[model samples]
Every structure is written in C-alpha cells, then in structure tokens.
Target: QFDQTIDYWGGRPHDDAWRAAAEQRIAELRTAPLTIRVNGALGAPVPGATVRVEQVRHHFRFGTAAPAGRFVGTDADSERFRAEVARLYNTVTFENDLKWHDVNPAEQQRIDAAIDWLDEHEITLRGHVLVWNFEVMPPRVRDLDAEAMRAAVHQRVTDQVGLYRDRLYLWDVVNEAVTNTEIWDRIGWDQFPEVFRLARAAGPNIGLAYNEYNMLNDREGHWRRSLENARRLIDAGAPITTFGEQAHQGVPLVPLPRVLELLDEAAKLGLRIEITEFDLGGVDDEEVHAQYVADFMTACFSHPSVDAFILWGFWEGSHWRAGENAAMFRRDWSKKPAQDAWEDLVLNQWWTRAAGETDGAGEFTQPVFYGRHRVTVEHDGQTVQAIVERTPDSPDWVMVSLP
Candidate 1:
C-alpha cells in the first residue's frame, strides 16, 4: 500500500507552523471563560468549597460511521464494536442500514435496536441519507419512469425521515448531488427541492444536510459544481441546514491552508459545515495518517462555521476502503498511530477537567472547552453536583446552591 500510494496525492507539508497556528486558534474559538459560583441555601457565599469540573460531552460532535449489524449483534466483536463506539464517539451515522438499497425488515429491526442503545448511552445518531443517486440506490429505481420515480423518491424520503424523525440529529437529504444526478434527471430538477421539503415536513426539527465528496480533498471543478448545485437547490426552496463534506483524502493530502480555505468557501453558504465522513486513505504509513488527521481536525476546529467532525469509519475491520490501512485502529484492535493521535487530541488536550477552590465571592473561574460538564462542589461535608452547559449564548457564571 505504501509503495502504491507513494506518489498518489502528492507530497504533504512537513512543517508545523500551520498546525501550531491552528492549535492557537482552537484555544480561542473552542473555549470560553467559565465561572462556577457556589452559594448556600440562604444565598450565603461558600468560600473555600472544593470544586471539580469534568466535561461530560462536547457540543461539537465527534463521531464515526458505524455498521448497524455489528452494533446490535451479540458476538464478541460486536461487543467490542459497541464499546469502542460508546467510549470514543458522541455520535454516529449508520453505515448502510438506513440506505435505500439496504433497507429491509431485518435491517430496520437492527436499526431500532441500535437506536435504543444509542439513546441509552446518550450517543446521538445521524441518518446516513434519505436519498442518494449512487451505488446505494435500490436496484430497480433507476429503471422507473417519471411518475413512478417521483413516488419512489417521495416514499423514500417520507419513510426514513418520518420513522427516525426526532431520533436523529441530521439527515443527508440528497447525497452526492453534483456527480450523481440520476434522481433529478429522472424526476426533473424541481424534484431535488421537493425531497428536501418532504424531509423537512416529516422531521421539521432534524437538520437537513447537503452532502458531497471531493470538494475538500480534490477541490477542482467538483467544488464549484457542488456549491452551484447547493445554491440552485436553496433557490428552488430546499431547506438545507448544513453542508456535509466527506473529507476522504488520498496521498498528496490537502494542505492545512487549503483545508481552511475550503472551509471558508463552504461557510459562505451560511450553513454550519460538518466534516461528515473523514478518513485518510492510500497512504500506508501510520505516522502520515496520524499527522494529517491531527492537522485536518485542527483546521476544522479553528474555523467557526465548522460544527462537527465525524470519521467515515474508525476500525480497520469495518472501514469501506483500504481496509486495515485506512482506519484509526487495526482489525485486531491494536493501537495504531492514528488512534493514539486521535485520543491524545480528543480525550486529553481538548477535553476539560479542572479542579480548584472557590474564592471569597464563592466563584471558581476557569477557562473551559465549550461543552456539557458535570460540576461537583463540596462545602461543609455536603456535596452538590449538577450538569451545566457552556455555549456562546450561555452566561459565564453558573450558580450551584448547597443543601
């Protein structure tokens, strides 16, 4: 694999300056000053109280594409798969179970079970897609005539989006529309907007995403075509709430500067940008993959419009392309360099876990990552803990009253 991809994408920059700049930007954009105020029942200050602020979940989604069969199965590898997902990701997109081709009674049952597990574990699930004109389409759909094709598209949107309405965080209403235009070609260009309208009607609260590939990695004519199509859909009344980039990269990786520039271009659409399906392929060197992963993540996080970072797959056992060479972990679950880099950033550097004592004003102030946190305060042998969240709109101070 290494020899094959040696000259594939091109030479990646070995400089650290761009990454350093991105990290600095992360410290500015991804965190905010938080003041945890401790007070008694009667509003008296509880100075000197011990306080611990541990982040519970990120407001920024970190996730992977998970296979429903493995997620809901009762085997050892299945157990490992479930455990790894829950431990590592706060969200997941169903790999194929929710797609048009794979949709079946058996798959639906597995999806239902997986939904239950995700809810129980407090993990958010994203519907992979409501419509795709590519390989995942139902076999005979392409052969249908205009009326039948229109009905098929509507039914597909209604069934999946309606079934998982409030359960999913987002849905790829129309995927890969730039290059894959069979749906629109058959039903007419207006059909594109109608599918989004149907999805919105079925699941009004769930975010609708316009997803595509190559826009970020290659960034040639594909990028312009995708952006133009997105504008066309929006102008025709499609309610696209987010832009999803399947940032699957080959060698001669997209540079850090280009990565940031592409994000800026997507941000011009005025919708949140999500790194929907991120993974580096073709390169067999674990170190190369790890560094690029870190660089890409830093670039995304530094951009204000980017909201989520989700891998196409995490385990080599379950990856779609390049198998063992394209994922963070090997098939045997060994720690690959990519896995270490991901954990080091997600679990350590970017995570917030601070401990301190309140001041004379009963306030313990700390700069923290923007996310949900569990705050525990101990005063005079009484312990009080509460779940708190910090966002751009949230107040800097959170008050916790003692018993």
Candidate 2:
C-alpha cells in the first residue's frame, strides 16, 4: 500500500499527461536558430545569445518577451558575436578602433578582418572616419613633412577605399577638420582637398560624409565655417554626399527644437545626413533619458534627408566614454531602460512591417509610411513601437522621435 501511494504521488496519470504535452509543445516550437542575412549574403550565426521580442506599449513601455532563439548559423566565434547583437539590438555598426593603427600598421589584414566580421554577420558597416585631424592619425604620419603627409594621406585613403569600395556604404571622409584650425594650418588645408579627391577616385559610389561636433550648440561662427567647408567640397565635385553630426551631448540637456533646426538646415544642402555618434549622458532619470533618446531619433528619422543614426556604443562596458552610462546596456550586458525605450520608439513603433497590400497599379506597397507615424510591429511574439517619418528624396531613416 505504501509503495503504491508513493508511485501515485510521484507519477500520477494526470501529472504525467500534462508534463508530456508541455514537453512536446516546447520541442515542436523550438527552431535550429535563425541565420543573419544581408544583401543576399548569409551572415554568421550566434550561439547562446538570447533574442527577445516584445510588443510596444503605450507611453514607451515595452511588452514582455514572446519567442527567441540562439545563434547557430556560422562559425562558433562569429555565431557568438551575432547572437550577442541579435539578443540586444536589431541593428549593429562596426567600430574602427583597430583600423586606424592596428589594421594598417603595416598591412590591411586588420581592416579586412573587421570588414569580414561585418559581412559575415550582415551588419551595416559605417567607415568610422576617413580623415580626423586628431585621435586617428598615428604619430608617425603626424611627423611627416607636408609633401610626405599628403602622400601618406593619399595612399591611406586610396588603399582603404579601394579595399572596401563596394563593401562599405558610408564613410566619414573628413572628421573634425574644422574644430582645430591649427592642425589644418600645420598639415596644410590644401591636403584636405586631396584626401577627398583620392577617396572619391577610389570609391565614387560610396557615401562620403564630413563629421564634426558642437554644431548643435548653434555657435554661429563654427557652424558657418563647417558649412562653408562642406559647400566648398561639394562645389568642387568631391563625393561629399552626407553631413555627419557627432551629437554627443555631454549632458541630457540639448534643446529638441534646436536639434531639429540643425537637421533641417542640413537637409537644404541636398545631402544625406547621419547622427554619426549620439549619446545623452549625465542624467539619472531613466524615463527622461529614454524619452530624450526617442525624441532625438524621431526628429532625425522624421527628416527625409537624414539617413541612419548610430549609437556610439550600445553597451556601457565597451563604450569609449566609460564613467558615463550612455549606452542601452549596462556593464553586465543587461538591458537598461534606455534600451527598451529605443527599441520601442525606434524599432517597433517607428519601423514598418511588410504588410501584404498593393497601393496602386498592382504594385505591392511596402509597409513603410512617411511623415512621423508611430510604428507597431511584432518581434519575437512581442509588440513594440517606434516613430518613423520621412519626406520624399531623403536617403536614410533617422530614429529620432519623442513620445
């Protein structure tokens, strides 16, 4: 009697039936990981990466996770990286820390590796910089004479551009060239034209951008100088296609309207635009910061002329500006409130899903909408929201929208 009672409690018919059904359903729903594909190329898969899909809720709240899978598409290492990004972000940008010195230190292998990684994962790669007056150039090149420097610049640009000509789409052709006039004076501003010229010659189809900081501050003189330089480059037939503003506001205090105004003016130039490096730091209010990020992305994405927006680094642990937690992820790879805010406002609410419908003349109309519409889409069985708006003739989507 005692043995029979123990068996009944441990393995009752009712409990065993329910457990078997649940296990069967779980096994049936499981997939062998999703592959990352970009432009018809298979991207590397990630393993052990958690992919969470949530719905967009009212007032910037993201819904709970629905369904997710691990990475199993490529080599083990590549798979790991891809899984990492897929778990946290739908979009990823390649960084250039190793490119400036390490890759070209003596050869292009390092640059090639970085490019290969992006290609393998089907990640959108932004050539961090073709020219920056500081922080990028090695001391060896800095010490070169004027002629040698020009030659060096020409070689570097040509080689780099030629190597990644068709692979990379956007480039920061001349970074911070205006911020420090003394450096230009020392290196000879004339060399700047050559840099642009060589890059165009090497990769004419790629988008070339001039990047700088503090333009949003509305410093009239500085703004004028940067614009003038851009105009000169454009007028000279340089492939100056985009204006990249490094919108790293040290504090979360930039005026939203002012930010819009700057973007509007850039549109007038008829060039593609990007908020190349954006980070709003020094604020502890997660809600406010999330709103600020959403608002900023909305304004940029709403503009037809703006193309793509890149968060400098999504994880605080890997961010260059360490002390400040400006990324969407905390140090431990967990999602910060800002991450949810961005995903809700930019991906779910702002992005348009492919709906089946023909707008006119039997042409299938894509789900994309124009002029600041809140987007709601299902990812991983969860609903998310983002604000997306664009005018005709704008090249890329800006992810700046406020709730």
Candidate 3:
C-alpha cells in the first residue's frame, strides 16, 4: 500500500506551534471592521437601535468535488448528496463530467442539468480540466498525428470553454502537466502555453488555473516541477490566474508545518493558491483523519494568498478512493469524525454573528468575518433588514433606513 512508503508522524509528539500561527493569521486576514448605520425614513439618526449581524455565506470558497450522476439523478443517494453540498459548500467542481474524456453530446445534457442546479443554489462552479495529458483520451485522440492532436485539443478547448464560460468561475486549463506529459510530448512544449491562450480567448472573463498533484507531500519533486512549469507558461504568455495543488494525502500525513511551508513557497509565484483536491485516503484511524483534516484546513485558511479549500470528495460511495473510505461521510450518509471537525470549523468556530444596540451616533461597529451578512435594525417598533457584503473593498459603513 502507498501508506507504507512515506514517513509519518505516527505516535509522535504533536506540536502546537503551527496551530497557534494559523489561528493568529486567520484572525488577522479573515476579518474586517464594519459599521452598521441606522436612520429613519426622513433621514434622522435612530440612536440606541437594536442591531443584529448574521453571516449568510463565506467569502472564502469552501467546496467539494461533486459527481454529476448523483447531483442529477433521482435516487435517494443523489438527494442526500445534493443536500449536503448545498449545506456545506459555496463552490463546486464536477468530478468527471467536465473532463476531456467525458464531455460527449450525451453527457452534455447531464452537465447542463447539474449547472442549472448549481446556478439555482448560487454555488460557484469551477471547470475541472480543459486539458489533461493523460491516458483518459477518447479513442480517436490516441492515434492522431502531432498536428491532428493539436487541432483536436484546440477545438475541444474552444468548444467546451465557450459553452460554459458564462457559468464557470474558472477552468483548470491544463492539469497534471508536471507528470502527465503525453500532450506536451505530442504537441511540443512550446505549444503548451497556447492551450491556455485558447482557453483565455474562449472564456474571456473566467480564471485559468494549472493544476497538479503531490505538492504537499513532495515525495516526487512535483512541487518544483509545478513551479517551473508555471514560470514557463507565464513567460510564454499564458494568462494563468491560479495555482492549483491537489493535496491528496495518505497514512503518514505530511506534517502541518511542512504543508504550510509548501504553501508559502507556492504563494511566491504571485498567483492565488487553491487546495484543489484534498482528501485523507491512507489513514485508518478516524480520529487521526479528523485531526489532520482540521490542521490541513487551518493551514490553508491561514494563508492570505490561498483562495479556496476544496475536498476531493465528501461521501465514500462516490469517492475516487471508495475502497479506502477517504471521504467524510459513508455510503449510508452517516457522519464521520472528519465531517464533524469540518463543520465545527466552517460553521461554528469561523462563523460570525453579532448583536448589539447602536450608539448615540446610530452606528454599530464590529470586526466580522468577510462575507455576505443580513443586518437587521429595530427602533420605534419598526424593523428594517438589509443584506450587505463585508469585503475588503466594501465601503466603511452600511446604511439601513427604518420606516
């Protein structure tokens, strides 16, 4: 098994330094001060008004890789999957439906339905991969000559990216290029950046990301390769906007400190880093899995350059490593310790809710987690509510006028 091959922290003394640093950074970077102002309909300040601020969503993207089969099907499992997704995540990436091999005419219908559901929920969708230089190519692609393969790839990128550009927040323009070099060898390394150009032209407004695996552990020098490839692509005029690290870990988990170090190094590229595919597949103990999950999430969340933390899968039945039980929930949808840990952090520990009476200036000010908040004020037997987004770029104060 893969677990036996790597070094682990098994039964070793756990250090609290990394956790402390993460907590400090989370407080410093994830919060902002906001002032809520209340006024009467005629523009008089309503002093001592009761004010409440409740966060409705997170600005940071907490996401999962969703299987379209479950999202679009009518089965009980599908219902459960969709419910959990809507409850737990604000962003999603289709597991296999958006990949090169699966984007056929028949699968497009299912993809459309899934996109519709995501739109209705207001969840952000990321296109999994526009190009993966792996063996999962269609039969026609396997035997094509160099020129024909280039043409095929160009057409595929144009068609798929143009089709869903409006709905997607980003696209993995090229995936795992560090290790999977079939396309690189077939089309020449010089043309790799052109693929990103194709995606940029097709999806003018969406972000383009280059995704790779094994950067967290770095047993294979994949992190260095990713950095080198990123520089090459950028130097050659690829408008790469994000760096995607598929943080798939097994039994001997990479230490939290090392993970943070790698993140810092990746952030040096001046691109937003995403923990694109995170899952604990190799650990046997549930408690260990949960702790690692919390630590990994904290490390990622603490980093200012990190934009999103996405789970590879959430349920074991639909998980890629289903045999190893790498998900937070079982096939029956029962919660695991990892799930509890995730919820506690995402919903309770990191969540923001505040209530207070406005001052003589009719202003209530507090530091809050950055996100959309419903601000409610009550005065003179009248209640007024307004939704405001508390981003770094938002104005200093929000105004809610009472009737």
Candidate 4:
C-alpha cells in the first residue's frame, strides 16, 4: 500500500503475456492491498494495486421551496425555515416571496435576509417571477397603451434585475405568458425578447429562465407554445438559459412514464431544464405521495438535459395551498414519508464514497459525480490534503502530491 498514486508506469510497453499478467494482478487489488515497481520502460506489473477517485461538484441540482420569513416568522418558525432549508436543499425559489404583487419593504427585508444566508452558505436562489399578467400585474399599468406597457415592462425588468443582480442565481425572466390573458395580447406576445433582454442587460451572468405551469398535462399545446416562446426569446437575442417546467402534476397524477414524456419535450428546446415548482397536491394519501415524489424525481434526474429540480412547498405549516397539506414535512417539523423518500435517493443512493490503497506504481481511480471534492490521503504518520475538482469536461487521472 502507498500514497501519491499517480502514474508509475511512466510510459512502459508490454507484450500480450505481460498484459494478461497485469490484468490478473490488478483484479486481485479489488479485495486487498498491493505494491509494485515500474521498470520505467517495460511497464511491468509486479503485484498488488488499487485506485481511488473523488468528485468535487456534481452537475445535478436538487432543491425545494420556502415562503417568506417563516412566512417571515418571528422565532420558532424562522429557525425551522432557516435550519431545515440549509439541511436539505441546495437551491430554492421563494414560494410567493419575491413576486411583484406582494413587494413591500418588510418583505424585501425578509428576502434580503434569505438571499444573504443562501449566498453565505453557497446555496442557489431562483427569482419566482419577473413579468406576469392578471391581478399580479401592477394596477397602474392597466391603462397604458402598447408602447407604454412595453416601456413599463422594460423598466420593471431593469429595476428588479439591477437590485438583486449580484445575488440572483437564476431568474424567471417570464412566467406563464401563454395564457389567454388580454394584457399579454395587448403588449404583443413577441415582447418576451424585451423582457428577457432587460434581465440579461442588468445581470449579464445570471441564468434567465422562462417558467410556466400545465406543461405536464400539455393543456392545449401550451407546452409547445412555451417552447416556441423560449425559441422566440432566443431569436430576439434574449439570453434564455433554462426552460422551467412547473411540474404541478395534479393531485392524483398520471403514471411516471407519461410524466417523463412531458419532461422530455421541454428538454428538446436546446436549453437546460429545471422542474421549477413541483407539488403533489389534491390526493392526501401520504404513502402514494411519497412514492410519487421518488418516482417523479428519478425520472427528472434520468434525463440528460434536466439539471435542477425543485418542489413548490415542502411543509404543511407554510404550504401555499390553503388547508391542503401536500408537503414532505409535517407541521411539527417532522419528516414525512415523501421527505425520507427523496432524501434517500439524492443524499444516499446516488451519493458516492469509495476507498483504495495504491500499488507500488501510484494510481487511484474511481467513478464519482462531477464536482469539487475534498480529498485526504494518508499513510503511516503522514497526511496530505487536496482539493480535487471532477468536472464532466475534465479528463481523468488527477495527480495529488503527498508528504
């Protein structure tokens, strides 16, 4: 057994017989420790060997939703929201926190606190919405004509992005613009380019997303229209980075196959996919809901284009849907069946941990997620600390020095 297992072969050649012997010798490394010496020319394997691999940052993003301040609560509620959100999720979208209709100084204060905490902890934040219609739209804008409305929209986009430009992880540049709402009809559906354009101008590096619901049910080709809208934004030169599927798959949802099929459609738009607002409401069966969450999340993770998945609300105490407790956490801050199910998958099953000691020719290799990893190598009384980043775009065989 040894440390600093990099390349000991140092470009040595071997014949078929030698290769066979090396394969047999390496196979034994899986069960026990081994050591070997390199000829520096023949590349001969003398005996025992092992390889270790680690991931630094994974490509997948698993997250959940929360409301404003324990709903912006005082003590217990605030602490629960703060601690639990950090415990489980890596990304979050304010349930109704940062919307335009409910913007207030106090609410903004609560929001500032949340974003600050997330930033300090290196968590991701998603802006719920930027451009919307129907009641949520400002009352002052109703009377504005097409040109004025466009100007108002631009101003709104510019102002919001400017305010949170540094802390924004992703922006819902436009939300549900495919509705039959007359306000959108007045301003021109094609104006999303302007809305998306403003967001990019203010926060050039922020991820801009077009988020919409009902894409799971297809709902009269609204999903198709949503994709078309995304493309239109791109055509108009808006930096649209993700297609958000608000996977509100109804109370008693359809089979997982159909759910995956719907997710696949959004993925085809050539943009990254995010299951932005997910909630298993309507049906109250906890057992079924837990299974649905696990299955649904698995489907989303299986897709190559899908990267971020978020639940709308995960606690009965603060769920947006009144009286309906379609949450993964109980009101008393206890873990529900669904919570355990999702956690079991994201934090346990797919989580990687492996160890191996190197042969005389130093080399350790293992399959791990693409991310930054803290690597520790030890032998005898010596210890080595290394920061290794395993990225999909990066090649294998990282060299770590040991003292």
Candidate 5:
C-alpha cells in the first residue's frame, strides 16, 4: 500500500495548482545562488576544453555475510572482529541470526551487536533465509505434522521478519527449496508460493528472494525445478525482487562461459541476480585461487544482470568452511592471492580516475561510477575546487570557475 501510494517512478505529477503556486512563490523570491565567475578567462581557457569529473569509487556495494558470534569480545584473548569487517565490506548479512534455531538468548546478543555496527556504519543489510529447512530448523517445527508445520511456518515468518520490518531491504524468502521438497513436502508444492507471499506481506518493501545453489552448473535438471518454482511464485503474486545463487565451488569451479550463460538466463527473470554466497575454494595454491577469483568476479561484474558479488566470509578464522583453500583471507589477516585479485579489480581497474582538458563553457562530462568526487579546474596557473556528487539520477557534469 505504501509503495503504491508513494510510487517514485510513475507517480502522478504534482497537483497543477500547487505546482503553479510554488513556482510563482519561487519566482517572487530570487535568492538562488548565482554562479561565481572567475576573471582569468572569458571562456574555457583550453581549446576543445572540458572539465573532467569522474567518480573514482563505485556506489555499487560489495558485501559479505558472517556469523555474529565472532563479534562479541573485549578481552586480550578476543579481538574486535567487526572492526575488521568495517574496513572492507559496505553491506552485511547475519550468517545465523535470521535462522530459526539460532535465534536463542545468547545469539540475540550477538545479533543486536551486529545490527548496531551495521547501523553505525550505515551499511546495507540483507536478511538471509527466512525459512530454510535444509540448513537449520527448530526441532519442534521440524517434527510437527503438516497442519502444525504450516502454522509454525507462518508464525515464524511473522515473528522474525516482522521484527526487522521496514529495515531489511532484502530477505531470502525461501532458500534451496526449489531443489527439493523440504518446504513443499510439508506445505504441499501447490502452496509453496505461500512462503513468498507471507514473506512479502511480512517485510513490505523488502526484496523477497528465492536463493538456491547449483543454478549456474545447471546443464542437467538442476535449474529446471527452481526456474519453474520462481515462475510459479511470480505468477502467484509473490513480490519477488531478487534471485540469488550461492556460488560455492570446490574442485570443479563453474566455467566462466557457463556462468555467463546462466547470468543471461537469470536476467530473463526480470529481477536482480545476486551472487549471494560466493566462495572459490578446494584449491591449495593461492595463485590458482586468485586467478579463479579474478575470472569469476570479472564474469559476474561484467554482466549487466548481476548486481552484487558477496563473498561468504573473508577470513579463515571466521569462515564456516574449513580449509586452506576456503575463504578469501588467511588466519593471520594477511591478504590471500584471491583477495588481492578481487581488490585489484575493484580498487584499481574499476576505480575511475581521469585527467582531461575542459571543454568550452568550462565544463567536463564523463560517464563514471556513481559516488562523491572532487573536481579541480586549472586555468592560467590558478586552481579552483568544487565538490561533485555523481549519482544515478543526476550524473553528468560539474561546473567550476576561478574565485
């Protein structure tokens, strides 16, 4: 109801009388700031001149999910883990808090602390797995008959999702259920869409996602059921916003061409394709891991459909999967080859920084990433500075002159 009422994209124009009156009032008061013209030059000092303003940092969020239990500590024996996380990722997903069995008293403390850190940093949050029966289930709910389980599902959705209502931008409405009958086995496959519907109702504008693994290597029948399941949920009026594939690879990591092919197919769904749980493991050689990470991340980011590439966890100490091959970071907090590869792409290659001659009218334009930037204009050996905000809605040019 709220989204419909406050439709930002296609909402009706402002009331004509209100707009006319506002324009009239604005015209009556001419207090708008005028441009400061520097006398160094009559026009752009450089021929074919244009001022260049490029967003060096991407607004696109790079994120990861981790266990909250790793965050609680104040002694010499314990380290400030969340502080380390604050240095890298811009978004976070609680690895355990959103699950049913893990929402106990002890876990709640950790969950609260994680939320505080996220809020303090103003980081985006994705709530994972509202009703994932395969991963972990409350024992009581698991053993119940169909009717009791049905009630339990709805109740849990309401309880947990409702707790973070209007806060989480996305939620894994039903996880890995498309691959099996865990959820539909109890609720009936015909009513499987109910989980998504309940989640949409529980979390209003939150993105209800259908997250599953093996969607990429679906040369077999791996993706058939999941694809059809997504169709069913969409047709049934479930406000599914994003589709996720847990990209965890071992010995046989997904081929780059195959992953790109899957990305094309996922784009057909008309939703954001999130590589939610991405990890390239099962290789002892860090160089191999680094190359694989480079290829995998390049494929995902290059594709137009893919939105985010969130690693499962960064450090081996906090990683749920155990192995030298697993996770992006080593035990001593040193960057692995894989981490270096990813950082190089995001920070060096993708980072937009450019120097160019300003065009006539003392303006420069370039399509760069969306973020904050500082534009410096040089004319006649004097420099003038102005802040440039590159955003999606308004990303074009920055104007500057000598003061």
Candidate 6:
C-alpha cells in the first residue's frame, strides 16, 4: 500500500491498501500499449494540437480539407490537418460568434462550413452561445420596442438552439447574462428564464450552461448575487444543468478561497458546474501561472459537482484576448509552463493508469482501484505512461483508457 499523509490541504495520506493497489496499478500501466480513438459524437478536433502520453508524443490532425479562404489560405493541407487533429485533441468546440452577429456576412454558409468540416473529421460540435447580451443585438432589435426586442431575443434563442439541437451536445444558453444585472432587472428576470425554457423546448437532452466572468474575485456581494441568481433560476424551473464561471481574469486576481466558495455554493443547486472559459494571464512567470492553474483545477475537480473544464481557447493565437497571452500554448504552438503544470497536476498526477497481460484475444482487463494512477508501458527498451483518474462515482475507465 502507498504511504498516506494527512496535510492541512484536505488530502489524506494513502493507506497501506491504497498504496499497494496504486503500486500494482502503476506496474501494469508501465507495460500497457497505447491506442487513440476519435469519437465524432464528441465534436470537432482542434487542429495543430499536441498530446503527450508520458514521454510519448501524439499529434492531432483534422481531416477536413482547407477551404479557399483567408483563414484557410495559410493552413496545412486537408489530409495533414486531419491526421494532426486526430492525434491531438479528443474534442473541439466550433467557433460560433460570427453566426450570432446581426448581419452575419457569411451566416448560413459559415455555419454549414463549420458543420461540414467537423462532420468530415468526425468531430463533435458545441454551439458556443445562444444569447450574449453584448454581441447578438441586431440593429432592428436595438431600435424596436421593448416587447419586440424580447420577442426577437426569444426567437433567436429558439431558432439557434432548435436548429443545432441534434448536432451539438451543449450550449452556453445565455452568455454573460448576469453581468448586465440592470438590464435583466429592467427587462424582468423572466427574460433570461424564457431563454432557458425556449432552449430546453428546442433541445430537451441538450445541456444548458449559464456562463459568466469575474466569479473568483472573492467579493462577498458578487459571489452571493451569482449564487442567488442560480437559485432563482432553479426555483423558477429552468433546465439548467451546468453553471459555468468564466475564469478570464487570469491568476493573480482570482482568489482561491472565492473559487472554492463559488463551487461549494453552486454544488448545492444540484447542477454540474464547469470552468468553461479559463485563461491564465498577466503573470509572466510561467511557474507561478502553472501553480495557480494547478491549484484552481485541484479545487474545481475536487468539488463533487464539476464535470469538466474547457479552456476558452487552448492557444494564445486563437484566444479572444490573444494580445494578452492568456492561453496554455504560445502563438508558436509551444506549451507554456502553465500547460505543463496542468498536464502534471490535472492530467498526470491526478489520474491513474495500469497495464495487464493480454488474454489470448489480446485483451487485458483490470479493476482500477479508486483515485488517480499512472499506467506505464515498456516496449523495446522504451517506456511510456498514460494517466487516468478514478472518480468517486464511476468505475468505468475502459472508454477513457483507449484514448
């Protein structure tokens, strides 16, 4: 069994049994082979992304051919993009802001293009947002009467959510809605509720998220108001499955205590929570940036309610705040120190992996004892390790193991 230590940080030392199981799991992991699986149901794979399995390297290539466009003009060949995406990201989120613009220059075509590209690459698509108060107002709606404006908003929500319901798994039902408290108060809280209702009506099984920013400031009133809004929504019967706190402000300003408080409060609502838009910034010290990310992720995953974390944009070049250098990867696609920290703490250190002798059918089955383990494999004098984590609720890691 692994030795256990009880520290003030809420982690207990591993007991003997736990240690023994971990050692056995580690040994098994050291001998396992590797395989990568792509699931079209999960959405599009981001191109030019790199994934590491301990010391082994895997590159994700998107299969979609490059279109004759400004953006695609400089991109890699279609087949190469496909292979690279397949090797890198397990999932991809469709860039949909342009589709929400009032006079979207390429509206239908752009949406179709993204969908087609993802389909060809067998990538899953996530409809970024349904209602972003600052971004979606058409000139006509802006000039319309209050009632008409509300109707327009409702229609927009219904149309977008309904149209993509079958293809997208999740939607930022209302992005940054709470930030404009005055607008919501004046328009009636029902305006937001209606958006949620319309989205659910359009797509029953689709996951809905309420995404926002500055949630980790540690300001008492801010935290209280955020939680109160969530409670109010749940009380009003909105089909809100997730609460997304946008961590865009970057490290130094985001108080750890406040993040924990937000998680704890949100968990009470019985909804899954996500740090949907995370970007670490400002601090040039990579180590500090990484530690902050590690600590933040540890707190987030440690919470029972958080299901997953989606970085706003993984690379600096594509980040909304690209000029500020707020992403895990630099513009050149080289990972920053924060990236390593995240990989180590969240992906490797917190995950568990194991390998076992294959049966006559070249299949191996082993029960991964609870908690995180690193599985390794030694082939032809070289060793590789894969990280896996055990959650308190599920025992199934088979699907995760293949990737």
Candidate 6, residue 236: Cα displacement in angstroms equals 1.2
lDDT of 4 by residue, 301-402 (tens): 766677788988787777876255577888888988889998787666555556676555655545555555556565544556566655545554455554
The TM-scores, one per candidate, come to 0.94, 0.66, 0.95, 0.81, 0.79, 0.68
lDDT (Cα, tens digit) per residue for candidate 2, span 1-403: 1232223122423212233443343223211111111110132221222222222212111111101111223555435445556444423445554235535342355445555655675454667666676457788888778778777777888987887788777677788767755446766777666677788889978878888787665566877788888887777777678898777764525555566678777677778777777777765666666766776666665555655666776666557764665777676667778788776755555533443321222222232433334433332334435543333434333221112
Write the candidate numbers in order of decreasing TM-score. 3, 1, 4, 5, 6, 2
The worst-scoring run of ten residues by lDDT in candidate 1 lies at 1-10
How many residue-pair clashes does candidate 1 contain?
A: 3
Deviation (Å) of 11 in candidate 2:
69
Worst 10 residues of 2 by lDDT: 59-68
* All candidates in order of lDDT, best leading: 3, 1, 4, 5, 6, 2
Candidate 1: stretches off by over 4 Å: 1-14
- C-alpha RMSD for every candidate: 2.6, 18.3, 2.8, 12.7, 13.9, 10.9
Error of 6 at 28 (Å): 19
How much lDDT does each candidate structure score? Answer: 0.86, 0.56, 0.87, 0.68, 0.68, 0.56
Candidate number achieving the greatest lDDT relative to the actual structure: 3
Residue range 166-235, candidate 5, lDDT tens digits: 5677888888875557867877776667877787677777777889887875444777777777788778
Cα miss at 208, model 6 (Å)? 1.4
Model 6 CA deviation exceeding 4 Å by range: 1-88, 95-99, 103-105, 119-123, 181-187, 251-258, 345-347, 350-353, 358-403
Taking the tens digit of each residue's C-alpha lDDT, what string does model 3 give over 125-159?
98988889657678788789999998989998999
Query: Which tens-of-lDDT digit does each residue in 63-170 have in candidate 1?
Result: 999888877789887899889988889999988788887456876787899899999999999888888874677778868888998998898899888888979999
Best candidate per TM-score, number? 3
- Model 5 segments more than 4 A misplaced: 1-57, 75-80, 372-391, 398-403
